[model samples]
Target: MVVAEIAEALDVRTWQLQEAKDQLSEVIETAQVRGPQMITRHGRPRAVLLSAEEYLAMTSDRPDFKEWLLGGPKANLALPESAFKATGEAKVEK
Candidate 1:
């Protein structure tokens, strides 16, 4: 979900969040203790607070992503030769 939706779920006014500044440690601790925080500035939410675990999951490698994408649609869609010229060969075919 977008950070705005998270703010709404947490019942926080978008403008009520604090400025991120250099308070990452404080923000993270506060967020962990109080759920995610919304960093705001000039009365607008700017960023989100995610736990280290959450962050790791977000940035973590998607082991099955390629497989998932390739397995999707399960149909062949032909493309021009020029497309492969820049995109490289498809390791798997439909």
Candidate 2:
């Protein structure tokens, strides 16, 4: 879901957060099982509580630019022998 939607779904207002300070265990538990928990301040979203596993999963290794380019679409084109000549337009086969 989108960030705003998720925030609305698991929103914790400023005062509510203060009240739940002693019971943060529940917050942490819910955040882990139900996705990110949003903390709002003055009606604006301030922060989020995400499980470590989820955080790590989001930040996991990914292919670098070179690898991505190499793995991209391949073009199997045919060129005439004189295509590389210095004087005229290259002849390319469709």
What lDDT does candidate 1 reach at residue 28?
A: 70
- Report, for every candidate in turn, its global Cα lDDT versus the true structure: 0.66, 0.67
Residue lDDT tens for model 2, 27-80: 788778877766655555567778899999997897888998999999878665
Candidate 1 wrong stretches, greater than 4 Å: 1-8, 12-19, 59-65, 76-94
Candidate 1: worst-modelled 10 consecutive residues by lDDT: 12-21
Candidate 1: give its CA RMSD in angstroms: 10.6
**All predictions: root-mean-square deviation over Cα?**
10.6, 6.3
lDDT of 1 by residue, 16-88 (tens): 3444556666777776676656777665567677777777878877658788788678655777667776788
What TM-score, over all chains together, does every model reach? 0.49, 0.49
Candidate 2 backbone collisions, by pair: none
